[model samples]
Target chain A: MTYTAWILLTASLVGLSCGIIGVFLILRRMAMMADAISHTVLLGIVTAYLITRELSGVHMLVGAIIAGLLTAVLVQWFHSRGVQQDASIGVVFTTLFAIGVILIATQVGNVHLDVQHALMGEITFLPWNTIHLPVIGDIPKATLMLIVVFLVVLAFIIAFYKEWKITTFDAGLAASLGIPVVLMHYVFMTLVSITTVASFDAVGAIMVVAMLITPAAAAYLWTDRLSVMLVLSGAFGVISAIGGYYLAVWIDTSISGSMAFSTGILFLVSFIFSPNHGLMSRVVKPYTTTE
Target chain B: MSVLAVRDLSASYHKNKVLYDVDFEINQGSLTGIVGPNGAGKSTLLKVMLDLHPKLSGSVVFFGKNLSQTKTRIGYVPQRGSVDWDFPTNALDVVLMGLYGKIGWFKWPSKKDKALAMASLEKMGMADYANRQISQLSGGQQQRVFLARALVQDADLYFMDEPLVGVDAATESAIMETLKQLKENGKTVMVVHHDLLTVEEYFDHVMLLNKTIVKHGRTDETFTKENVQATYGGALRWMKEA
Candidate 1:
C-alpha cells in the first residue's frame, strides 16, 4: 500500500481501539485518567530513553505503562487521603509532563522535539518507515502494534465484562459480596495505561484524550446498555477518523487536531440531540407531550 | 450458637470515631432490629460487620468462621441513597451483581444465574420490572430492587440498612414477607430500622444503641420505654408512652 493508504489504515485502527476502550473508562468515571496517562507518558518515554540509551518502542511502552500506573496510584492515594481527585490528577500529571519537556529540551539536542508534535502527531509522515511482513505485505509497524493493543483490550473487556460492570456500578456492594473491587479497579487502571501507551506515538497526548473520552461520551448519549454503548462508540470513532483525515487534507490542518475536533463536534451534537437524556430533550421537554 | 459475633468493633469517619468498642452477638434464624437515634452508629456498625468500612480494632465471626472467610454466605443491602440511581443499569442488572461474587472474575452470568436472579426478583414482586432502568423506578421499587439484589446472594445471613426508608406500604409488606421467609429458612437478618412502631411487630430481638449498646435482648424485654429513654432521650420515651 502507498504511504497515504498506510497512514489512513493506522489512523482508523487507533480510532477503533480508543473508542472501544473509552466506553468503559467513561462509564467508570475515569475519563480524566486517560488525559492524565497521556501527559505522564511523555516523561516515561524520555526517562526510559535516558536510562536505556535507546528509543525502541518496547522501552517506551514499558516506561509509559509504569508511569501510567504510578499516576493512577497517586490519584487514588490522594483520593483516599481526602484530596480532591481532579486536583490530584492535574498536579501529578502536569509535574511529570513538565519534567519530560525539560528532559527532551536539555538532553535530546540532536532531535527536533517540539511541543506541537508532542501534543499532536504528524500522521502524514508516518508511512515513510513502513515494515513488511511475509504474508501481510508492507504495513505501518505502528498500525500493527495498535491492532495488537486493540485485541488485548477487547479480550480483557469481553472476558471481564461482568466484573467491570458490577464494580463500577456498586463497588461497596460488590466488595461485600467478595468481588475484589480493589483488584478489579487496579486491573482497569492497568488496561487504561496500556491503551494510552499504545496510542501515544500515533495520536500524541492532547488528542489522545479526545480519542478516549469523546466517542464514549457520545455513545453515552445514544444508549442505556453498556454493550450497545461500546459498539456505538467504536463505530463513532472510526467515522470520525476517516472524516477527520479528509477534512485535515482539505483545510491544510493537523490530522490529530482535526480528528479530535471532529470527535468533539460529534460529542456536542450528541449532547444536544440525543433522544434519551440529551440536553435538547431536557430543554424541549416542557413543550413536548408523551404518549 | 451465635450465627454472628462482633468483638471490639470500632469504626470512624476520618478523625471522628462513630462506633467505639461496640460488641454484639446474633443467633441463627433471628430477626434482629438495630434501633438507635440518628448518628448513633447503627449504619456504621452494619458497615463494620460487612467489612465495608475500615476498622480501628475489631474482628467479626460468622458461622464459626471469620467474616472475611464467610463472605459468600452474607448478603448486604446498603441504604437507598448510598448508590447513584442515575446509573444506566437496569433492575435485573443490579440483581445479577449478587451472583458475580459466586461466579468470580472473567466470567459472565450464566443462564442458570439469570434464572436464579429472576426467581429472586419474582419473590420481591419485581419480576415484571426486570428490564426497567433503576432511575425510572419509584422509591419503593428502588428499595425492592436492592433487596432483590441481596436476596439473589441466597446468603445465610443478611445485613440491610434502612430497607424500609422510603418504601410504600405494599413494598414494605413485600420486603417484610421476604425477611420472614429468610428467618423461616434459618437465615439470620440484622436490619437497621428507623420506625419505632414496627419494632415490636417485626423484630424478634432488638438492640437499642446510642453510639454504644444501651440494651439488647428479646423484643419484649429490651425494647421498653426505659431503654428508649436511655438510648435516644426522654422525649422518645414520652412519645412511646403516649
Candidate 2:
C-alpha cells in the first residue's frame, strides 16, 4: 500500500529467505561459502549489466547463479588439489569481487551503478523502481522478486528437508545412502546465489552477509532442534527487518545497515542469555546448583 | 555365495599408495573384522570397497551386483567422531536418516519409520535417550546412537568403522550382541576393529591387513600371534614371541 510498507516487506522477505538458507550453511560449517557467494555474485551482476546494458532481473539471476557455481567449483577444485578449504574460498571470492569492482569502476561507469549502493544498499529508494500489474498496480520490483525467491526457497526447504538434514549432518552417510550429495550441494549453492541476487538491491552485499548468518547463528544459540531453529531463525530475521526499519526511520540512516545491526544485537543477546547454551547459563549454573 | 567380493583393490591418497592389490571375499551371514596397525590401510580398504574413496584399481561386488545397484541393501556407520555432534538434531532424528533411503525422495518419514527407529534405538539401549540432543550424549552413548542408526537401515550388509572405539564396557557388549543378532538374522557385517584381544572373540571371520591382506580366514584358524605380528609389523614382533 504505502512506500515504507513495501520497503519493509521486501526487507523482511529478503531477511527471511537468507536466514532460512543460512541455517543449512551454518550447520554445514559453510558460512564462509555464503560470504563467498554474496561477494562473487557481484562479478556476475556486473558482467550481465555490461553485456545487456540493462539492469534486468533475469540477466542478473542467470549471471549470479553461474558465477556462484563457478566459485563453488573453483573452491572445491582447490581443496581437492590440497589447498585448505577456507583459503580456497578466500582466494576465489576476493579475486572475483575485486574483478567486479574493477569492472564497475572502468567499464560500467556510464551506467547508474553506484559503488556505495552496491556495497551498502539504499533501501529507502527501493519503492521508486515500481512495476505495474493488473489489479495490484505500482508494486516495487524488488519486493516482487524477493517474494518469489522467498517462496521458492521455502518450497525447496520443505520438499528436501530430509535430504538437507542428512547431508549437512553426515555427508558420508548421506552418500552411502545414495543421496546425491554433490548434486544437493550445487543446488544449495545455486539457491544461495539467487537469494544474494534478490537481496542485493535491498540489503547490499555486506548486509546480506550479516542477514544470512547472524539470525541463524542467534537461532542456533536458542535451540538444539533443527525444526525449531528454522522457525526461530525466520522469526528473528523478520523481527530484525521490521525493527530495523523503524530504527532507521528514527535515526535517518541506511535501513539495511540498521537491520544488520539489529540482527547482531539479537545474536549477542542469544549468546549471553540463551537458557541452555548461553554464557549466562554457564555462569549461573554452579551457584544455582549449590544453593 | 559371497556377500562382498573385492578383487585386486588398490587405492592411494595423493601420491602415496595406501591399499595395495587387496583381495577378499566375505560370505553371507559372517561377522568379519578388519584389523591392522595405524596406516595399514584397514579403513582405506573398506572405504575403497564402498567407493567412498577413489580406487586406483578395483572391482567390488555386493551380492552379485555393483554398489549402486545394491546400495539399498547396504548400511554404513561412519566413525562416531567423523560427524559434527553439535548438529541441531536429536538421537532419533539421526537414526531416522537410515530410513530416508527406504522412504525415497519427496516424502517424509511416517509413523512406521519412527517406530522402526525407536525399536533400533531400544536394541542399542538408547530408546530412552532418543529425544536427547546428540551433543549432550556421552561418547559411548553417541556411539550407540550411531549403531542404532545403522541398525534402522535394516540392511542385508553393514560396514562399520571402529564402532567400538572409546565406548564403555556396557556399550561395547551391547554393540557386540547387536552384531551377533545381525549375524543371526543372516545379515553380513564387516567392521574395522582395533583391539587385538577381541579380534577372535568378536568376529567369526578375520582379515589382518598391512597395505594388503596378510591373513584372512575363519577367526580360529587365521588370528594367530604370527599373523598379528605380520599385520602390525616389526613394531609389534613381541606379540608373536609372547
Candidate 3:
C-alpha cells in the first residue's frame, strides 16, 4: 500500500501493455508511426479538454483513440499516394502536436499539464489519485486502465493468432485469403493508440514510444515466430518496467525515463546476444563446436 | 466452363494507363499462359483480375458471380519479391494462410488445415523446409513455397504472377508439375509469364499481350512469330534463336 509499491505495480502493468502492442508495431514496421501516434494523442487530449472543459480519464482515452486512428489513416493515405511514407507521417503528426502545444500554452490557464510534464511523466505522484473499486479496494486509476488494456490485448492476440500472424507476415496474401486485412490493420492501430494514450498519463509521450518499440525490437532479435515474439516482448517489457522503477528510485529522477532507459539497454543486449540475429552471436558462431 | 472472365478492364496508376480495354476468359481444367514484354501490364492485368487494385475499372466475374463473391474460390501467388522475404515467419505458417478464408476470423487452423498445408508443401518438394524461415529459402525454394501456399487454398482458380521468375530450372519444373496437377484436378491456372521459350512447352493456351491482348488461343496457334512480334513490339524476333 506504499506509494513506491503502487508506482512499481503501475509501471509493470503499463510496460506489459506496451510490450504486447509493440510486437505488432515492430512487425508492421511502424515504429515511427507509433511514435507519431503518441504525440498526436497529446493534441487530442488538449482538444477534448478545450471542448468539454473537463479532465476525466475516460474522455482523454476516447479523444486519444480518435486522433490515433486519424494519424494511421493519414499515414496509409500518403503511402498509397506514392509519397514517402515515413516523412508524411512525421509531417502530419508533428503539425497536429504543435497545434496541441500552442493550445495548451495559450488556452489552458490552470491545468497541470505543461510541456515538461508531457515529456517527463510523474509516476511517483500517481499513487495519490484513488479510484476505489468495491472488490479491490483503493487503486490508482491508471493501474486499473493498464490492467484492462493488457488483458484485452492478450485475449485479442490469443483469439486471433492466425489472422494477426498472417497479416503481419504478408498483408496482400492475407487480403487475398479474405481475412479483412484493412479492417484488421485499423483495429491494431486503434489498440496501439489506446496503449499510447493510456501510457501518456503514466510514462509521458516520448518514453511511451521507447516502450512500444524497444521491447518488440529486442524480441525480434530472439525469434522468427509471432507467438514467441509476443511472449518474449511482454517479458522484456515487464523486466524493464520493474528494473527502471528501481533505477529511478536509486537515481532520484523520473520513473518513465528510467523505464525507457532500461528498455533501450535491454535492446542493445539482445542485439548483441540474440542467437540467430545478434552481432556477437554470429561472430562467435564459427568458433563454437556444437554444430 | 470458363471459371473466370474479365471484360473492358482498364486500369491506371496515377493517371498513367496500364491496362486498356483488356478482355479474357479462363476455362476450368486448363493452364493459360499470359505472356508480355516489359511494361506490357502483365502483372497489372493479374492484379485487376484478382480485384486487388481499386483504380482498375472492369468487371471480373468468377462462376458467373462478381469477383468479391468468389473470393474463397480463388488462390493467389503474388510475385516472390512482392513482400519482405525476411519477414519473421516459417514456410508452414505462410502456407497455412490459404486456409484463413475457410477457417474465418479468430479461428485456429484445424487438424485438417495443417494436414492440407503439409500435403501442399510435400507436393512442392518443400515439406522438409516447412519449419525454415522463408528468407532462408533459395529463389527456387521461395517460388515453391508460394506454390504450396496456393495449393493449400484448394480453390477452383489459381492466379500466379511470374511464379518462375528467379527460380532455378529444377524449381521451375516443380512449379510446372504442380500447375499441371492443378489443371488435372479441374482448377483453372492463369500464370503471368514473361519468358516466351516455355510458352510452347508449359501452357496449353496462350494470350500474347502488350497493353492489350493481340492474340489468345491454343498455345501452338497463339505462339506464332507474328503474335510474338506484336506482343513484344518486334523485339521477340531478336531474342529468338533461329
Q: What TM-score against the true fold does each predicted structure earn?
A: 0.94, 0.97, 0.96
Model 3 / residue B179 / CA error / Å:
0.8
Error of 2 at A175 (Å): 0.8
Indicate whether candidate 2 or candidate 3 has the larger TM-score.
2
Error of 2 at A41 (Å): 0.3
Of candidate 1 chain B, the 10-residue stretch with the lowest lDDT total is B233-242
Model 2 per-residue lDDT tens digits across residues A95-145: 999999999998987776767878897788889988888987888888888
Stretches of model 3 off by over 4 angstroms after superposition: A287-291
| Interface RMSD, candidates in the order listed | 1.5, 0.8, 1.7
Error of 2 at A270 (Å): 0.4
Candidate 1 per-residue C-alpha lDDT over A1-291 given as tens digits, one digit per residue, 9 for 90 to 100: 776777777788778889988887886788888888888888888888888887666787788888888888888888878889899999889998999999988987676345667788677777765677899887766776787788988998899888778788888888897877888887777777777777776788888889989998899888768888889898888888888899999999888888898899899899889987788887877777542
lDDT of 1: 0.85
Identify the CAPRI category of the predicted complex in candidate 1. Answer: medium
Write one digit per residue (lDDT tens) for candidate 3, span B27-121.
88989999988888888887777767764666888999986788888888899888877778899988888888899866788898989999999
CA lDDT of each prediction against the hidden true structure: 0.85, 0.91, 0.85
Of the pair 2 and 3, which is ahead by DockQ? 2
Model 2, residue A10: C-alpha shift (Å): 1.0
- In model 1, the fraction of reference contacts reproduced equals 0.62
Error of 1 at A207 (Å): 1.3
